[model samples]
Target chain A: MPPFSRFTALTEQLPASVPFVGPEVQERQAGTPFMARLGANESGFGPAPSVIAAITEASATVWRYGDSESFDLCSALARRLDLPCEQIIVGEGIDSLLGLTVRLVVETGTPVVTSLGAYPTFNYHVTGYGGRLVTVPYRDDREDLEALRDAVLREDAPLVYLANPDNPMGSWHSADAVTAFARSLPDTTLLVLDEAYGEFAPDGVLPPVSDLAQLPNVLRYRTFSKAHGLAGLRVGYVFGTAETVARFHRVRNHFGVNRLGQVAARAALEDAHWLDHVRAQVAAALQRLAQIAEQNDLQPLPSATNFLAIDCGSAVRARSILEGLNAHRVFIRMPGVAPLDRCIRVSAGPASELDAFEKALPTVLAGLT
Target chain B: MPPFSRFTALTEQLPASVPFVGPEVQERQAGTPFMARLGANESGFGPAPSVIAAITEASATVWRYGDSESFDLCSALARRLDLPCEQIIVGEGIDSLLGLTVRLVVETGTPVVTSLGAYPTFNYHVTGYGGRLVTVPYRDDREDLEALRDAVLREDAPLVYLANPDNPMGSWHSADAVTAFARSLPDTTLLVLDEAYGEFAPDGVLPPVSDLAQLPNVLRYRTFSKAHGLAGLRVGYVFGTAETVARFHRVRNHFGVNRLGQVAARAALEDAHWLDHVRAQVAAALQRLAQIAEQNDLQPLPSATNFLAIDCGSAVRARSILEGLNAHRVFIRMPGVAPLDRCIRVSAGPASELDAFEKALPTVLAGLT
Candidate 1:
């Protein structure tokens, strides 16, 4: 049958495309689970034991809808960040929040600025809302802040996105640089400063929470998926000025965040020692990943996040290596655009999974050669 | 600081109103937990033991993202419903799906039709997308199907929402009647046939899945939240023609459904015996609720779903009874619009919770008198 005839013109014009093809899809196609699942930047380290307990405990109460307000989680987040509860709004994940943010600011033909080949989910939301994308190419495997600012100004873009400790290439800027770039933006331009990888970055890599909390146009997004190791639970939040964050309530799915996510995230927050252990594991895994890339004659890019991007020297080589790894039952991803596409990204995970990737990489590279 | 300057004019114009204040929020304000939690229509019997076990088992893997495709869950649903897997799309919840549906069809000033006291979340989503709502009031305590059809025809609305075994009043239309109403609408008017409470509804209250699965403009929304007792898990799905269902891919949060939710929902769907058990419990609880209302000299409406709406003779009496119930630590709700406001709605729950309500009702009623 023909598709529904009444979908909006924008929806009709849009192509059906997912931002990411999950590793499970590949597993189904291959008819076997990957021996090492590392794709999509999910932490193989998993969540804290306390978080697991919380989720298991919460299992009995799954009949109750999650507090639509996400009250406790937001309050705990506020306390940790030294911000008022009004400054924080918890959501299903950074992806869901990004969708809401785009919906709030984007209208048909509205211009939105972002780095080319950045987080595709942000771009998906922008295009989903019929916003015209203004792309700024990365410079030296890092998002070019100056160029992004230029594009935002040139297009008179009302919305802009920047991910610190960036995805795919795993590149980052100093906190001061991010602060300067954020401060440089016109008040009219709202900045979605995604800090999904902030927990893994060096101390100096993230500005103090208070530094940008007062900025009405800056909403800093963070997730438990990375260092906190709860990707499957889908908990994330954005914090900004009370006035700006409150606007999320005007459009957000109030009960979108699952009950266990709130429970798991709150437990994850309380377990600081577990977070520290995960960070240590991620740091060690990054080194092992770098060594593996070097052993395979690939250049591993410097990373601030819990993943390493190995420069396979060319887009063709990167694609071949990625497919070769997949064929060897090691799941990994790569950047989708030029320049950055020369690299394949591997998320930090447990030693056994990393060992599988380590054991398979040389053979996969040799097969490609 | 002022709110972000880039929020669209529509977003700025919208108020920060949630469809319902969760019991948790009310508990916070009241400084104590409700003795009976029945306000939100969530199942109090809880999910099946197998589902709980699945959640606990899946708790260890909360670091991995849920399969973006929701492959296994969709396949299971398709198998059970005798539909192609491509015809179903699993999402965070019915609420989130409603938001996406509105976004897909409602552009600025687009007309959408629904009953006056229907699901507020749908209205919130429609208004969030700048859709002009054309509401037809309920007739005789049930959604006036004829009036709804007339409104759709009169407004030339692209979208119409009707929840079978509907919320608030817990009234239902026969499957044949619903099928006829759906067939009568213009193919251009997409019908969001919400069957959130379908499992609790009597047999033949829902058309066979195959009957409307072939219709491009008729999307059937079902959830694990109601009878399956997994509201906290936030899993729901929509099924229609493959072509129309595929459109969800263009805008859905690919990994929005949490991993444990996927696990729990799949488990819940498999446990038919558990569903039957819950239905029996709900049936008994509904009768008990009706007895309590009648004992208090209030009239209880006939219901096919898992709730009873007690008519307190007038809107003022209903409001007073609802407030008295709140003061007595018995959580229940009433419809928001006039006429419907004369009814106080109570969900079917465990005997302990209902016993608490049963004990408190007379006292609350006497206090009100």
Candidate 2:
């Protein structure tokens, strides 16, 4: 049968691909569930008991749709961050928010800037909105802020994605460096500062939330997916200047967020002690990951976030190591392109899951050669 | 402190708005929850017990992101529909899917077609994507198939939305008419057949799934929101020719659909008895609603779906009745556009709530007069 022919040329030209083929897909293709799932940067500690209790309690009230304004959650977030509620807008996840921001700024051929090997989902949104992507390669495994700023200025790009305590590599710059980069960007450029992993990052890595509050050009993105451990719940929030944040209402799927997500996220926010505990756990896990890399004669890159990127020397070797880990029922992944692809990225999970990875790594490396 | 200034002109021109302000927002503004939530077409009877059970069961694994592929749910949905898994794609809800479809088909100045008072969410998506909506007014309170076809042919609209057992009016075309409408459209005109309320529609109102299976131009939309009572779960699916469905992956938020939504929807699918019971309840509720309308000296339009649209003589009277009902703590909604706005829409819920409506209708109308 012939396909529907009405899609614009840009959509037709795009490949049928996802930013990441999930680890669950990997398990399915392997025809067995992985014994250790450390590919996705998920907290294996699970949500705090309070969050689960909240979810279970909210289950009876699931007949009602979530608050379209997400007022309570926004108020909580704003209070914690010292911003007014008007500056905060909640959505399904930062990924959905990224897509909305891209849509707002992009028309056909509009230039969008990001790192060469940064988050593919951000790149996907840029292309999905028919924007021209201008990417600068990572300088020393960190998103080269100077190059990105230059590209934005040179191309007059209206959108830029910056992940602090970044994904894949899990590397970061200091708060001052990030603030400087933001201040340097043109007012026309809308910086999507994704802090999905911010809760897991070292304290000093994330600039103070109030630092960017008045800048309409900066949208700081965060999620319950990482440290809060509710990725499956699909809740995230974006906030900045009220003027810019208000624009999200124009295009957001108002009732798109599930009821449980709202319940789980609100509860997660209320449990800051759990956040601290999870942060400590993730820090310990990262240390364990670094030790494992060293024992296996691999170099583990420094990460402010939950995941560790261990350089396996070459992309070919990294691929084999990833496959070997999988063969041993340890699921992990790596970046897609170039120098970054030379390292395998593993998320911090439970101790037993990390033990499985530690045990499997040496054997996987032995089999690799 | 200056704001970002580079949004597309169309986006800048659009108002910051939600298609429908959720009842939760209404409750916040009113400082009290509605006693009856019959406004949003949500199933107050609630999701199957088994579905909530699935949610509580899946709570542990929610720390991880959902399957970007949404494999298991899509496979189950495909099997139920007898389509290849490749031909089925799921999203946060039909709202999100509509946004992606609009992105695929619409550019600035792109002509899209739909009924004058159709699903506001679809129109929101079209406007968000800068599509010029060419609306064909409803005929006899049902979506006008002949006029929509004429509009599509005249403007060569690339995308058209048609919801069966449609919202607000709760009216439908017979399967023969629906099929004829589909068959009448040019292959180039993509049909977004929203069957969000299909589960409650008369059997003959829904075409055999196979009838449109080979028509690449047809994409049938279904949701767990209506009869299944999983609206709060944000699970909706669309199925079409494999080739047409493939395009969603090119632009969709792969992990946008929540894990609980997947689990709940699957469980909802499996609970055939609950669905059957709900449909039966809906049929009875429709009758009760009609009786209430007749008792109130209003005309309840013939309905194929779970809601009743009671014509109150004129638009102003309908608005007054709606406001009066809400003032009495009974939440109900009406279509926003003319001819359609001449009626008030009431969703099917447990009769105890409808009893509140039954009792309040007279008092509300007495004051309206």
lDDT of 1 by residue, A1-369 (tens): 689998888999998898888989988988998999888788888898988988888889989999988999989998899999999999989999999899899888999999999999999999998899999999998999999999989998999999998987889999999999999999999999999999999989998888888889899999998888889889999999999999999988877889999999999999999989999999999999999888878899999999999999999999998899899899999999998999999989899999999998888877876
Q: Lowest summed-lDDT stretch of 10 residues in model 2 chain A?
A: A60-69
lDDT of each: 0.91, 0.89
| TM-score attained by model 1 | 0.99
Query: Over the stretch A165-283, how does candidate 2's per-residue lDDT look in tens digits?
Result: 88889999999999999999988888999998888776789999878788889999999999999999888999899888888888888987788898889899999899999988998
Model 1 chain B worst lDDT window (10 residues) = B360-369
Off by over 4 Å in 1: none
TM-score, chain B, predicted structure 2: 0.98
Lowest summed lDDT window (length 10), candidate 2 chain B: B1-10
* lDDT (10s digit) by residue, model 2, range B1-369: 445788889888898867998887888889998898899988888888888898888877789888887788888888888888988998888888888889888988999999999998899888887889999999988899999999999998989999988887988889999899999999999999999989887769999989998899999999888888888888888998999988898999988888888888888889999998888888899899999999889999998788899999999999999999998889999999998999999998897899999989999888865
- Candidate 2: residue A80 Cα off by (Å): 0.9
lDDT of 1 by residue, B217-326 (tens): 99999998988888888999999999998989999999889999999999998999998999999999999999988888989999989999999999988898889989
- Score residue B182 of candidate 2 by CA lDDT: 93
Model 2 scores what on Cα lDDT? 0.89
